[model samples]
Target: MRKRIIIFDDDKDTRTICSLILEGLNFEVITQENCIDILRILDLHTPHVILIDNHLPGMKGAAGIRLVKESPRHKHIPVVFFTGTNNAQALADEAGADFVLPKPVDLARLEEVIELAINS
Candidate 1:
């Protein structure tokens, strides 16, 4: 079965591009504009990996990551912090993400990180 990845990003372009790229890589991609119902989403999708943006409409990525991390059922899923901040790494570390991807995204790096997160 193809591995599934969930991307929570507010930007339409980013989500579209990422969905396309990941789909091309033989991944099943699911995109959402916000993580308002993160745990519910996780339960529904059961993604292999999660890519979340820092600035979201309702719940921030860090908070959502925390929820996932705290959940025994979902804690094992690797999370990639996707941000455009200068302190991306620090923010990701604080958020307990397994990896970080900055925007505007570097395609090769995005692919590499996703692979690592999936394998991890």
Candidate 2:
């Protein structure tokens, strides 16, 4: 079965581009504009990984990542924080994210991170 990935980003272009890239890599991708429905989505579809933008509409991506890591059902799933900030890696680490990827995402790096998340 193809690995599934859930992505949360407010930018339509980012979401679309990431989804397309992930799909091309044989990953089933689900895109969300915010973190509001994360629990619902997780309950329905257990994605292998989650990619969240640091700045979101409702909650900060770091907080969202914390929530996911706190949840018993979803805690095991790896999370990657995507941001344009210089401290993206530190923010992700503070939030308990498994990985971090800079915005204007490099497709090759994205693939490497996803593979590492899945394998580890």
Q: Which candidate is the best by lDDT?
A: 1
Q: What C-alpha lDDT do the candidate models reach, one value each?
A: 0.94, 0.91
Q: What C-alpha lDDT, on a 0 to 100 scale, does residue 20 get in candidate 1?
A: 95
The 10-residue segment with the lowest total lDDT in model 2: 36-45
RMSD, every candidate, angstroms: 0.7, 1.0
The TM-scores, one per candidate, come to: 0.97, 0.95
Model 2: per-residue Cα lDDT over 33-93, one tens digit each: 9997788888888899999998899888999999999999899999989899889988888
lDDT of 1: 0.94
Q: Write the per-residue lDDT of candidate 1 for residues 20-118, one digit (tens) a residue.
A: 999999999999999999999999999999999989998889889988999999999999998998998988888789998888899999999999998
